[model samples]
Structure formats: structure tokens, C-alpha cells
Target: MGNSTFVFVVFILVYLGMIFGRLPRLALDRTGIVVLGAIALLASGHASLEGGRSGIDVSTILLLFGFMVISAQFRLGGFYSEVSRRIAGLPVSPGALLGAVILVSGVLSALLTNDVVCLAMTPVLGRGCIRRGLNPLPFFLALACAANIGSALTLIGNPQNMLIGQYLNLSFGGYLVFAALPTAVSLLFLQGIVLLLFRGKFLLPMAAKEEPERPFNAWQTAKGGIILCTVVLLFLFTSLPRDLVALGAAGVLLLSRTMASRRTLDTVDWQLLALFLGLFVVNGAFEAAGGLEIMKDGLSRLGMSLASPSRLYGVTTVLSNLVSNVPAVMLLLPLVRDIPGAGYILAVSSTFAGNLLIVGSIANIIVAGEAERMGIPFDWKGHARVGVPVTLASLATGLACMVLI
Candidate 1:
């Protein structure tokens, strides 16, 4: 078979594995599948090992790794837990509490990684709701939806955004101009939907109970907070590369005397990193073999042009749901690299699309699983009841925002 044909086959298998989240009847996960695909290309003489390694974007990976480390510091320092505990303990009523949840989740997810935000907050939020004798479903649902929406606010908010921003060389400040308004609108939409759907339940009397929480480590929290602020500021105003700024912050956090480097580093999602590396190689091999050009030609014949922001938005929304946002963005990036404002559109649409279904985004999945573990029983039907409406509302608002701005 030709090199292009071999690369194409490998691409198909890797994406299929992504869609299924694993290979059936094999212990191999999505990361393993993609790694195997890259290996397959190398063994078949379709791609050189050195060439495949070069396909990986080191800056994107470093940025992602740095953020994960920063998030880990926050997690271990009890920042996330303390914040949620304070929010839940507020003297406000249930409706206000829900609004608070939405606002906090959205903002934090925008700055921090959304999945880590969801993972850290879900358990505490669930426990708080149960302890207060309030239904946990709406709050948990809001956490997931808001995190997904808020994550669209910045390139560092989620993995796909990071990849798109780094690969397309998008300006962090410029993209935020287009993203902030839509993300705010989406968060408001999500809050309203949850309120309308779960009305009357927020007025329940608070039952006093012991809320299990990590003791707030003031020093560690302060250390992490300072570093995080420095990183964000550097990214915004300085011409310094984001990866270097983030890695520098992570290094500062790692130098803590009280916190063990091992504890902080352990929180890094190495599997996700591996998955990224493997997919980078796989996609690189395909691109090197001219597979992207072939796909572009096929799309052209079908009268589909990804260079158009609107069409790219629609395609990203569909593919994000079909194969999850990170993989979807990776698949689409090579095609729309030069399209004006393509990065911003892809980031917003794909991230918002995660609210369409529980399975659509890793953030949603993390929230759902965490809720279930907390005995909240967050099933698909409950999720879709809120997800579908929120997603549509957000997407409509985001699309309009893109057009207007």
C-alpha cells in the first residue's frame, strides 16, 4: 500500500479508538491506541521516528504540563476545596447558591483547566448539597455545564484551546475579546436553565451537618496563588512565550519547602499527556503523507470549506461531540490554520458543545463520575435535560457573539 494509504488507515483507527475511548476487548485505552498507531506508521516505513517526534508541539505540551502542575498545587494546597466550602457555607438561599456555583465554576475554569476544576469541586459541592438537605443534581449539573462554558473564555482553560492557541499562534488577549462575552452569556444561560428546571427546590431549609473538607493550608495556597497570578499577568502583557511563563510559575510552586514535589507532581495527568503526544505523532505522520491535502480536496469536492469561520464552527461542534473536543480540535486544526479567527471560533464552539451531552467532554465526564461517587446519582437523562438546552442557548449566543465581534 502507498504511504498515504497506510497513514490514512492509521488515522482512521486512531480516531475510531478515540470515539470509542478505547479499543474493544483490549486493555488498551485511547492513549495506547494512538501510541500504537504512531508505532504502526513507523514500523510500516510510512514515517520516520525522528520526524514523528518533531510533529509534537513542545510548547503546547509544556504549557499544558505547567498548568496541570499549577492546578495540582491548588488541589493539594486546599484552595479549591476551601473556596467551594466557603461558597456552600454562605448565608444565601438555594437559588443564590446555584448562581454562585455557576459564577465561581465558570471563572475558575476559565483560568484553571476545566477538567481539574470539575474534578476538584464536584465532590465538595455534592457533599455540601446533600448535607444541606438540598438536591445535588442541579448544582452538580451546573458545575459541569458552567465549567465547560467558562473554559471557553481563554486558551488555557482547556486542552483544545491550548492546542489551537499554540498551533495557530493566536494572541491570548485578542482571542479573549471574542471569547469573554460569549462565555459570560453562556454562563448566564446555564444559570437560568438550571433555575427554571429546578425551581422551588432551592428554598429548602439548610440542615446543619459536618461537611468533610481538607484543612486549608494558608501558606501553600498563598504560594500557588502568587505563582498563578504571575503566570497569567505574564501571558497577558508580556511578549514572553506562554509555555515559558507557565513552566516558570510551576517551577516556583515546585520549590516549596512544606509541600512535597512528589505530591504536587503526582496530580499531573500523565496519561492525558501521553495521549496528546501520541495523537501529535499520529496526526503528524498523516500530514507528512499528504493526508490533510487529500481530505481538503474531498471536502472541497463536497462544497465544504473549513476556511469559513461559520462552517468551521458547525464542523467543530459536530466533531467535538463525536470524538470529544481535544481530538476534534486536533483533527480540524491543520485544515484551518490560516483562516482568520478560526482559532477563536473552534475554541468556543467545541468547548460549548461539551454541554450537549454528558459524554461529549472530559470535563462533563469527570463531573458526572465524581457526582456518582458522592452518591448523587447523576445519570445521562438528568444531564441531558439541562445539557441540551444550555448547549443550544450557549452555542446560539456564542455564534452571534462571533458574528458581532
Candidate 2:
């Protein structure tokens, strides 16, 4: 086979590995697949070390790293736990709790990445529901769906948004103006779906519950809170590089005298960071092999311009479900050019698609993991009952907004 064909085959295998959650019969994960692909390209003289290094987008890496660090601070400080507890204690009805979960998830997701918010919030939410003698399933589902929907509101909400923002050079405020209404509407749609699907259960009275609480690390929470606020302000006001801002915040958090650097580092998902680096290199090489040009031409032939709202939304939704949103975004990035509303479309469609299936997003997987740890049964069928309809409804709303406004 030609070298191009060989590289293409390897790329397909790597993505397949990602789909199965790891490489077959190997103690390797998605990050490993990406790293292996990059190595294969280099070994076969398809790419060089300099090429690999150049392939990695430092801005994306820095932004991801900064968010991870900021997220770590929240995780360590027990802020998520506090928020969960406060929600649990609200005197409102179970329906209100459902609304609160979706609202909080959406709001926090716009600031922090959806996956991080879900990872930090799920366990606390699960435990809180159980303590209240409430079925944790609906609440947990709300958390997952809300995070996915809410992350669509801003450029920093998900990795796909960051890529779109950087690629399109979108202004933070402009993206928000275009996305905020759609995001809000999507959250309401999600809430309505959750209430209807689980109405019988959500309306039932809860048993008397112990006062819900978790160990609160005030110092850690404060540190995380400050860093998160600073990062937002930086994004809004200063012209400093986004990634550098995130990395610098992470550095400050890591140097905390109260928390060991090792502990802070341990909280960081090194695997996730590696996955980004690996995908960067692999996708970079794929783009260099004329695959991207072929894709652009094919898409153009199909009359699907990435700049078109309806087309972009349709393509992003299908691709997100097909390969998972992150990888799908990486594949589609080459086809997207600087356009007025491309960032909003990319962020909205990619994120909302995550709500379509159990396997659709990393946040869903994290929620599932937490469910398993808590001895809660969570399966694809169960999730799809809420997931599929909510996803479709939100997607329709988002797409309509994109097309109409």
C-alpha cells in the first residue's frame, strides 16, 4: 500500500480503539492510541519529531491545561460537594431540585469544561439524592444533560468550542451573545424532558434526611474560586494568551502552601492531557497527508459549507455521535474556515450531541463511572430514555435558533 494509505489505515484503527475505550488486548487507552499513532507515523518516516512538535497547537494545550488546573482546585477544595449539598437542602419540590441541577450544571459548564463539572459534581449529587431517599437516576441524568447543554453557551464550555474559537478568532462576548439564548432554551427543554420522563418519581415525597454535608476545605475552595474568576476576567478583559493564562493560574494553584504539589498534580488527569497531545499529533499528520484537502473538496462537492448554520449543525451532530465529539471536532476542523457564526454552531452542535447517547460524551462516561461506584445501575437503554429525546429536542431548538437568529 502507499504510505498515505498506510497512514490512513493506522488512523482509522486508532479511532476505533478510542471507540472501544482502549486498544484490544493491550493496557492502552485513548491517549495511548494517539501516542502510538504518532509514533507509527514518525517510525514510517511519514512525519518527523519537529513535525510532531509543530503539529501540536500550544494554545489548545495551554487552555486545556489551565482549565484542568482550575478544575483541580475546585475538586480538591470540596466546592462541588458544597454546591450539591446546598441544592439537596433547598426547600423546593423535587421538581425544583431537578431544575436546580440542570441550572447549576449549565451555568458552571459555561465557565468550566462540561466534563470537569460533571466529574466533580456527579458523586456529590448521587450521594445527596440517595440521602434524601430520592431516586438518584433522574437527578444524575439531569446533571449530565445539563452540563452538555450548558457548555454550549460559551467558547470555554467544551474543547470543541475552544478549537472553534481559536480557529475562527471569535470574540468571547460575540460568541456569548449568539449562544446564550440557545443555551438557556436548551436547558429549559432538558428540564422539561427530565420532569416528564420521571414525573411520577420526582413528585413523590422524600424520607426525612440527615443534614447533608461534606468536608469543606475553605482554603482550597477559595484558591480554586479565585483562580476560576481570574481566568474568566482574563478571557473577558486582557489580551494575554488564553492558554498561558490558564497555565499560569494552574502554576499558582500548584504552589499552594496548604496543598502538596503532588496532590494537586495527582488530581490533574494526566491521561486526558496526554490524549489531547496525542490527538493533536495524529490529526496533524493526517491533515498533512492530503486527507484534509480531500475532505474539504468532498464536503464542498456535497454543498455543505461549514459557514452555513444548518449544514454545520447537521454535520457536527452526526459526526459527534459517530466518533464522539472531541475526535469528531478534530476531524472536522480542517473543513471549517473563519466565518461569522461558525464558532457558535460548532460549540452548540458538538456539545448538544453529547446528550444523544450514553457513549456520546466523556461527561456521560464520568457520570456512569460514579454511578457504578455508588452501586447505582446505569445502562445505555436507561440513559437513552432521557438522553435521546432531550438531545433531539435541544438540537432542534439550537439549530432553529442558529437558522432563525
Candidate 3:
């Protein structure tokens, strides 16, 4: 076979691996697939280290790494625990707790990535709901759905939004104008769904509390707070590259005297980083092979351009569910050109689409992982019950917002 054909075959395998969540439990993960693809490209003389590196967006990697550090700081700090405790402490009905979960999930997701928000909040909320005589599943699903919906409201809400905003050069505030309304409506819709579907379950008798007081690390919390604030300010006010600003904050958090640097660094999900790198190399190769151009032409022939709001929305939603949002965005990005309000469409659709399935977004997976660790049975069917309808409702609302705004 020709070198290009071999490269293409390896690339196909890599994506297939992504689709199946791994290479069928073969000890290889997404990152391994990506790295293997890069090696294959080089071995077959289809590309070089220079080409591969050039293809990977250093800015995107830097930004993601930095945010991971920032998120790690929060995880150690007990901020998430504290917040969950405060929310649980509210003198409200079971319904109100559901609303608070959705609200907090959305807001926190807008600041931190949705996945991190879920990672931090899931256990706390889950335990709280169980103690409150509430079925934890509804609340957990709310957290996942709300986070996905809320992340759509801002450029930094999720990784895909960040990539689209950075690549398309969408202003921070501009994207918000396009997404805020849809997100607001979607949150309300989510609240209603939980209240209707799980009302009886939520009102079940309370269980005896195991630990009345939530445990947290003060020093870790302080470090995380400082770094997060610094990164947000830099992203909002300063001219520094977003990636550099985030990485700098991460570096500072890692140098703390309280926590072991290795421990803190270990919390960073290197597999996710690997997934990004592998997919970047694989997608880059496809682009280099003129595959992307062909896609763009085919899209054009169908009277679709990424610049068209509805078309972009449909594409992002479909692709997000297919390959997961982040990787899907990476694949489709080249077809999109800089256009007014396009970033918002991409962000809204890709993020909201995550609510489509348990595996549709990393945030959902993070919540599921944490829930499993806590002995909660959060299976795909359980998730799909809430996920499917909520996703459809939210996507329709988002599409309407795009049209109106």
C-alpha cells in the first residue's frame, strides 16, 4: 500500500478507537491511539516530528494543561465540598435543591470546565442527596445536564468552546450575547424535567448521616482560589495568551509548600492530554491529506458552510455526540471560517449536545466515574432517561436563540 494510504488507515483506526472509548480494553487508551498514529505517520514517511508538532495546537494544549492545574487546586482546596455543603444547607424543598444544583452547575461550569465542575460537585451532591432522602440519580443527572447546558453560555465553559473561540477569534462578551438566553431557558427546562420525573423519589425518607461536617483542605483551597482568580482576570482583562496565562497559574499552584508537587501533578488527567495530542496528530494528518478540503467542498455542494448558523449548529450537535464534543470540534474546525456570531453557535451546540448521552461529553464521564467510586449506580440507561429528552429540549432552545440573536 502507498504511504498515504497507510497513514489514512492508521488515522481511521485512531478515530475508531475514540468512538469505542478505547481499543476494546486492550490497555491502549485514546492517547495511545494518537501517539501510535503519529509514530505510524513518521515510520511510513508520511509526516515528521516537526510536521506532527506543527499540526498540534500548542496554544490549545497549554491552555488545557493550565486549566487542569487550576482545577486540581480547587479539587484539593475543598471549595467544591464547601459549596455543596452550603447548597445542601439551604432551607428549601427537594425541588429547590434540584434548582440549586442546576444553577450552581451552570454557573460553575461557565467558569471552570464542565468536566471539572462535575468532578468536584458530583460526590458531594450525591452524598448530600442521599442523606436528604432524595434519590441521588436525579440530582446527579441535573448536575451533568446543567453543567453541559451552562458551559454553552461562555467561551471558556468547555474545551470545545475554548477551541472555537480561540480559533475563530470570537470576543468573550460577544459569544455570551448569543448564548446566554438559550442557556438560561435550558436551565429552567432542566429544572422542570427533574422535578417532574423524580419528584416522588426525591421526597423519599432521609438516611442517617455518616459525616455531618464536610471535610476539606484549607491550604489547597486557598491555592486553587488564587490561581483560578488570577487565570480568570488574565483571560478577561489582560492581553496575555490564554494558554500562557493558564499554564503560568498552574505552575504557581504546583510550587506550593503545602501539597506534594507530585501528588498535585498526578491529579492532572494525562490521558486526556494524550487524547488531545493523538487526535490533533490524527486530524492534522487528515487535513494534510486534503481530506478536510474535500469535506468542505462536499459541505459546500450541499449548500452548507460553517458560517451558516443553523448548519453549523446541526453539524456540531451531530458530530459532538458521534466522536465526543472536543474531538468532534477539532475535526470540524477547519471547515469553519471566522464569521460573526459563529463561535457562539459552535459553543452552544457542541456543549448542549453533550447532554445527549452518558458518553457524549467528558463532563458526564467524570460525574459517572466519581459516582461509581462512591458506590452510586449511574449506568447508561439511567443517564439516557434524563439525557435524551433534556438534550433535545436544550438543543432546540439553543437553535432558536441562535436564530433570534
Candidate 4:
């Protein structure tokens, strides 16, 4: 086969691995599969490490890595555990607690990466519910759904948004202007749907057995909080490059006396960063092989070129559900260049689409994994019951906001 054909075969097989979440009997996960694909392209002399670095968008990687470190600081400081305790410690009813879970998870997710928020908060929320004699299922679903919706509130909220914002030159404030209303509305819609669905099932006959989690340290939390806030302000107010700003903030956190850098770095999602790098390399080679152009031509012939924001939105949602959002966004990004308001379309659609299925986003997966480990029965059916309606409502709100903008 020719270069384009070889790239197409490797790309398709790689995405198949992504969909399946592993290789058949190979013990290779999505990142490993992507790394293998990149290596394959390199072996064929169709790509290079330098080309991958360029394709990876070094600034975006830096920004993502910096935030991972900041998130690590919070995780190690036990800030997320404190927040969960405070929420559970309240003298609130089940409905009120549900609303709080939705709102808090959403807002924190809007500020931090949704995956990190879910990873840190899931255990605390789950065990808190156990201690309270409340069934944790609804709350766990709420956390996952709200995190997904909330992550759309800002470009920094999720990886795909970061990639879209950095590569598209989207204004942070401008994107927020478009995203704020929809994300807020999506949170409200999610809260209502979850409350209504789980109203009668919010309690168990008895609280499940609970266990103690990581302890909170006030000084460590305060140190991390200061650095996080500074990073956010700099992102909003200054013209300085965001990657550098975020990286600098992360570096400061590494200087902490109590929390060792090794502990903080341990919380970083190195697998995710590697996944990004591998996708960048493989995707670069695929593009160079004219695969994107070929797909564009094929889509254009189908009257579905990405220049139409609506078509792009629809396609993004479908592909995100099929292969997960990050890979879907990477696949579509090249075609969206110069397309009006494509940034908003990609960000809004891909994010809300994640609520459609458990496997659609990492936040959802994190919550589910935690539930299983805690011996709570969380299944695709339970997730879909909430995910389907929340996803529909979120997409509707996002579409209206996009139209108004």
C-alpha cells in the first residue's frame, strides 16, 4: 500500500483500540495502542519526533502539564477531601445534597480539569454517602455528569477545550462569554434531572460500610489554593502566554516545604500526556499522508463538510461517543480551520456529548471505577438513565447559546 493507505490502516486500527479500550489479549490500553501507532508511522519514515512535537502543539502540552501539577498539589493537600466533607457535613436533605453535589462538582470542574476533579472527589463523595446512610449512586452519577458539563465552562476546564482554544487562537474571555450561560444552564438541567429520577431511591435501608480517606492539611491546601488562584487570574487578565503562566504557577507549588515534589508529581496523569503526544505524532503523519483531506473530500461529497457548524457539531458528538472526545477532536480539528465559530462548536458539542455514555469521557470512567472498587453497583444502564437525558438537555442548551452568540 501507499503512504496514505498505510496511515489510514494504522489510524483506523488505532481508533479501534481506542473504542475497545484495549487490544485483544495484548494488555495494551488506549495510550499504549496510540504509542504503537506513532512508532509504526515513524518506522515507515512518514513522521519524526520533531514533527510530533510541532503537531502536539508544545504550548498546549505545557499548559496541560502545568495544570496537572496544580491539580496534583490539591489532591496531595487533601483539598478535595475537605470540600467533600464540608458538603456532607451540612444539615441538608437528600434533594439539597444532590443539588450541592451537582453545583460544587460543576464549578470545581469548571476551574480545574474535570478528570482531576472526579479522581479526587469520587472516593470522598462515595464514602461520605456511605457514612450518611445515603445511596451513593445518584451522587456519583451527578458528580460525573456535572463535572462533564462544568468542564465546558472555560477553555482550561478540559483537555479538548485546551487543544481547541490554543490551536484556534480562541480568546479565553470570548469563549467563556459563549460558554458561561450554557454550562450554567446545563448544570441546572442536570441537577433537576438527577433529583427527579432518584428522588425515591436516594436512601438505603442502612448506610454501607465506610472507610477513612486521605487526611486534610490546612497549610498545604492554602499553599495550593493561592497558586491556583494566581494561575486563573493571570489566564484571565494578562497577555502573557498561558502555557508559561501555568507552568510557572506549577513550579511554585513544587517548592513547597511539606509536600514533596515527588508526591505531587505522582498525581499527574502521565498516561494522558503520553496519549496526547502519541496522538499528535500519529495524526501528524496521517495528515501529511493526505488522510484528512481525503476524509474532507469524502464528507464534502456527502454534503457534510465541516464548514457548516451544525454538521460539525453533530459529527463531533457522534465521534466523541464512538471513540471518546480527545481523539475525536484531534481528528476533526484540521477540518475546522477557518470555519466560523468552529471553536465553540467543538468545545460545546464534544463536552456535552460525553454525558451520553459512561465511556464517552474520562470523568465518567473515573467515577464508575471508584464505585466498583467501593462495591457500589454502577452499571451502564444506571449511567445511561441519567446520561441520556442530561446529555440531551445539555446539547439543547449549548445549541441555543451558540445560536444567540
Candidate 5:
């Protein structure tokens, strides 16, 4: 077969792994699949080893790694867990609690990465619900949905947004100007949909069990918070490169006198970094093989101009669920890279599209997995009941905001 056809085969296999979460009967997960695909392309002589190395976007990797370290600092410091514990301790009804969960998860997610927020908050919220005699399902769903919506609020909120911002050279303040309103409206829509769906159930308090949590470290938490604030200010006010500023912040955190760098680094999601690297190579080779141009022409013939913001929004939302958001964004980037306002459209649409189903985004998967481990039954059906409406409403809000802008 021709080189292009061989690359296409590998791409399809890799995406299948993404959709299934793993390859059947093969202990290979999504990360392993992409790594294998990159290897295959190199071996087939379709892409050289040097070309593959150059394809990996080091700046995106650095920025992602730096943010992961910052997130790790918060996780190790017990910041996320403590915040959730405090919110659950409030003397409020279940509906009020839902609102609090949405607000906290959303706001934190808007500041940090959504996956990290979900990873650190899921167990705390779940156990807190069980301890307070409230059902954990609604709160779990809220954490997942709200995190997805909230992550769209800023450029650094999630990986795909970061890619869009960096690739498009979008101004941090400029993108936020367009994204903030839709994100706020979506958050409100998420809160309302979750509240209306799980009303009264949140009020039934029944005590369950509690999991031992990490000791809250005031100093470490303070350090991470300070660094986070500085990084944000640098991103918003200064003209310095965001990746360099973020790496500097991560470096500062790595210099702790008490906490071992190993401990903080251990909290970093290395597998995710690997997945990004592998996809960069695999997708890069696929693009070099001329697959994207062929697909674009086919779509153009179908009257689908991906350069259009609205059309890009629709395709992004659908493709995100099909192969997960990161890869979908990678596939769509060449099509929309030059379109004005495409960054905001892609960021808001793909990130919010994650709420459509449990398998739609990594944040949802993390929340669901954490809940299941805590003995809470969080099935896809339960997620879809809330996910479907919240996704539709949030996307509607996003579309209206995009139109107004």
C-alpha cells in the first residue's frame, strides 16, 4: 500500500483506541496506541525519526508540564480537598450545595486545568456527600459538568484551549473578552439544569463513611496559590511568553525546602504528557502524508467550510465526542487555524461538548472513576441524564454569545 494509506490505517487504529479507551484483548490504552502509531509510521519509512522529533511542540509540552506541576503543588498541599470539605460543611440545603459545587468546581477549573480539578475534587465531594447522608451522584455529575464548562473560561483552563491560543497567537485578554460571557452563562445554565434535575434528593442527609485525607499544609498551599496568582497576572498584563512564565512559576515551586521535588512531581500526570507528545508526532505525520488536504476537499464539496466559525463549532462538538477532544482539535486545527475568532469558537465549543456523555472528556472519566472507586454507582446512564441537557443548554449559550460577539 502507498505511504498515505499506511498512515491512514495507523490513524484509524489510534483513534479507535481513543474511543474505546483501550484496544480489546491488547493491554494497550490510548497513550500506548498513539506511541505505537508513531513508531509504526517511522518504521514504515513514511516519516523519519528526525521529522517525528521536530513535530513534537516543545512549548505546548512545557506549558502543560508547568501547569501540571502547579496543579500537583495544590494537590499535595491539600488545597482542592480542603476547599471541597469546607464547601460541604456549609449549613445549606442540597440545592444550595449543588450551586456551591458548581461554583467552586467551575471557578477552580477556570483557573486551573479541568482534569486536575476533577481529579482532586471528585473523591472529596463523593465522600463528603456520603458522610452528610446525601446522594453522591448529583454532586459528582455537577463536578464533572461544571469543570468542563468552567475550563472554557480562560486560555489555560484546558489543553485544547492552550493549543488553540498558542497556535493562533490569541491574546490572553482578547480571548477572555469573548469567552468570559459565554462561560458565565453556561455555568448558570449548568447550575440550573443540575439543580432542577436533582432537586430534593440533595436534601436527604444520611451518614456513610469517610476517607482519610492528606493533612492540609498551610505553607505549601500558600506557596502554590501565590505562584498561581503571579502566573495569572503575568499572562494577563505582560507581553512575556506564557510558556516561559508558566515554566518559571513551576521552577519556583520546585525549589521547596520542605516538600521533596519527587513528591510534587509524582503528582504530575506524566501519562497525559506522553499522550500529547505521541499525538503530536502521529498527527504530524498524518498531515505530512496529505490526508488532511484530501479530507478538507471532500468536506468542501459537501458545502462544509471549516473556516467558518459556526461550521467549525458544529464539527468540533461532534468530532470531540467521536475521538475525544484533543485529537479532534488536532484534526481540525489545519482547517480553522487562519479563521478570525476561530480560537474562541473552537475553545468554547470543544470544551463544552465534553458534557454530552461520560466518555466525551477526560474530566468526566476521572470524576466517574473516582466515584466508582469510592463505592458510588456512577453509570453512563446517570451521567447522560444530566449531561445531555446541560450540554445542549451550555452549547446554546455559547452559540448565542459567539453570534453576539
Candidate 6:
């Protein structure tokens, strides 16, 4: 095979692993495939680590790492546990409890980023549901879906959005203008659809299981909140560069006398960061190998050039489900740089479409993974009972809002 063919083959194989969540008859997972792809490209001279160094966006990585530290503070301080306990403790019916889960998850994701929020909140919420004699599947589904929908509302709410906003140089406040309404409407749709699909199964009893949780610390929680707020405000009002601002906030938080820096640092999702780096290098190789030109022609022939916002939305929704949102978004960003409103197309479609499958987003995977660990039967089938309707309703709501107002 030619150099171009080799790089393209590697890219397809890596993404196939991602689509299936693992390689067939092999132990290689999505992260492993990505890392190997990047290594293969560098080793074969299809891409250069030195020349393609610029392919990796350090600012985006810093921003994601910073927010993760902030989220970790909440997790370690037991803030997430407290919130789940209080919400699940309300003297309300099962429907009311589901609403509470959706509401709290949506708002928290909008602020804290979705993946970490789901990771921190899932077990507590799962245990809370079991304690209340309610089945936890729907609740887990709601948390994952609401987190995805909620995280759609802002530049920092999810990894793909952060990558989109920072790389596109889109205004923090400007992106919110397009996102806020759809987010509100989509959260409502998410609640209704999940409730509808899981109609008779809401109050089924499940055995109680305790997962590891941190003791509550008010000082650490408060400190993390202040840092988060300051970082967000700077993102909104200042042009100090979001990466620098986020890194600064993270730096100051690391200087804590009470919490060990090791513990805080341990909370960061280093694997996700590494995955992003690997994809960047692999994508750079693909583009340099003239794979982009071949793909463009193929897409043009297939009548999905990605210039039209509607077509872009459809492709993004499908591709997001197939490869997960971050990789799908990373692959498409360079293709849409000059397309008007393509940023919104990517942000809304990828975020909302992630709710379509358990493998569609990291938040979904984390929640489902936690469910298995807790001995709960909340797998992809149970998830799809909620995911499919919720995805359709929310995507329609978001796309309409994007087109209309």
C-alpha cells in the first residue's frame, strides 16, 4: 500500500476499535488504539512528533485538566455525595425524584463538565435510588443523558465544546447565547422521555450497595467553588486566554495546605488527556497523508459535504454515536473552519447525539461502568430504552432552537 493508504488504514482500524469499544478478539481498547495509531504514524514517518507538535492544542488540554481538578475538589470534599443525598432524600414520589436527578445533574454539568460529574455522582445516586426502593437504571440513564444535555450549554461543559470554542476562538458568552435555550428545553425533553420509557419500572426495589465515598469537607468544597467561579468569570469577561486562566486557577488550588497535591492531581483524567493528544497526532498524520482530500471527495460524492448546517448536524449526530463525540468532533473540526454556524452545528449535534448510546459519550460509559461495579443491571439495552427517545426528542428540540431562535 502507498503511504496514504497505510495511514488511512490505521486511522480506520483505530476508529473501528473506538466504535466497538474494543478490538475484536483483542485486549486493545479505544485509548490503546488511539495511542498505537499515533505511535505507528510517528514511527513510520507518516507524521512527525516535532512538526505535528502544533497539532495538539495545549490550551484545550489545560482547560479540561483545570476543570477536572475543580470537579475533583468537589468529589474529594464529598460535595457531590451531599448533593445526591439531599436530592434523593426529598419527600417526593418516584417521578419527583427523577425530576430532581435530571435538574441537579443538568445544572451541575453545565458548571462542572459532564464526565467528571457523572463519575462523581453516579454511585451515590445509584445507592440512593436502591435505598429508596426504586430501580436505579432510569436514574442512571437520566444522570448520563441530563449531564450530556446540560453540558451542551456552555464552552466548558464538555470536552468537545471546550475544544470547539477554544480552537475556533468563539466567544464564551456568544456560544451561550445559542446554547442556553436548547439546553433548557432539552433537559425537559430528557426528563419526559426517560420517565415515559421506564414507566412501570420506576419503583422496583433493588438491593443496597455501598461504593467508596470521601468524607465531607466544607473548606475544600468552598475553596473549589470560589476557584471555579473565578475561572468562569475570567472566561466570560477577560481575554487573558482561557488556558492560562484555567491553569492559574488550578495552580492556586494546588497550593492548599490541607489537601495533598498528590490526591488532587490523582483526580485528573490523565487518560482522557492522553487520548486527546494521541488523536491529534493521528489526525495530523491522516491529513498530511492526503487522506483528507480523499475523504472530502468521498463525502462530496455521497452528498454530505458538511457546509450546510443541517447536513453537518446529521453527520455529526451519526458520527458522534459511532466514534463518540470527542473523536468525531476532532475529526470534523478542520473540515468546518470556514462554514458559517458550523460551530453550533458541531456543539449541539455532538453533545445531544451522545445521549443515543452508552458508548456515545464518556459520561454514559462512566455511569454504565459504575452500575456494573455496583451490581446493578443498567447496561446498553436498559439505557437504550431511555436513550433512543431522549436523543430524538432532545436533538429535534436543539436543532429547531438553533434554526429558529
Candidate 3 local lDDT, 1-405, one digit each (tens) = 876677678877877877876786588766677788777776766665584443778787787788777877787777788898788778898888889989998998888878878887887787777777767778889999999999888777788887887777677766777788999999999998878887677754545346544368887787677777777767667777787777888888878776788877887888878777777777777778877877888988998878877778778878887779988888877776546666566778888889888879988988888777767789898888888889889888987766666
Ranking by TM-score: 4, 5, 6, 1, 2, 3
Worst 10 residues of 2 by lDDT: 203-212
Tell how far residue 185 is off in model 3, in angstroms: 1.7
Number of the predicted model whose lDDT against the real structure is largest: 4
Q: TM-scores of the models, in the given order?
A: 0.95, 0.93, 0.91, 0.97, 0.97, 0.96
Pick by TM-score: which candidate is best?
4
**Residue 341 miss distance in model 5 (angstroms):** 1.1
**Residues 184-288, model 5: lDDT tens digits:** 888888888887887767754555666688778999999999999999999999999889989999999999889999998988889888888888888888888
126-169, model 4: which lDDT tens digit per residue? 88887788999999999999999999999999999999988898
lDDT of 1 by residue, 1-405 (tens): 877778898899999988887887899977899889978877877666573354899899999999999999889989899888888788888889999999999999999999999998887877777767788788989999999999999999999999998998889899888898999988988889999998876544444445567778888888888888888888889889998888888888888778889998899999889889888888888888888889899999998998876677778878988888888988898888877777788889999999888878988899889877665578889899999999889989987987787
lDDT of each: 0.86, 0.81, 0.79, 0.88, 0.86, 0.87
Per-residue CA lDDT of candidate 6, range 1-405, in tens? 899889899999888988887887888878988998888988987777674443788789889888888888888889998898888788998898999999999999988889988987888888888898988888888999999999998999999999999889898998888999989998888878877787898887766866666678899999989988898888889888998888888899889888899999998988898899999888888888787788789999998879877788789989998999999999999888888888977998899999888888989989989989988877788888788888888878877887787
Q: How does model 6 fare in lDDT?
A: 0.87
Clashing pairs in 4: none
Kindly list the per-residue Cα lDDT of model 2 for residues 244-329, writing each as its tens digit: 88889988888876778887778777877777777777787777788888877888898877877778878888778767898888
Off by over 4 Å in 2: 22-27, 51-53, 203-214, 301-303
Task: Give the poorly placed runs of model 5, Cα more than 4 Å off.
Answer: 49-53, 203-207
**lDDT comparing candidate 2 with the true structure:** 0.81
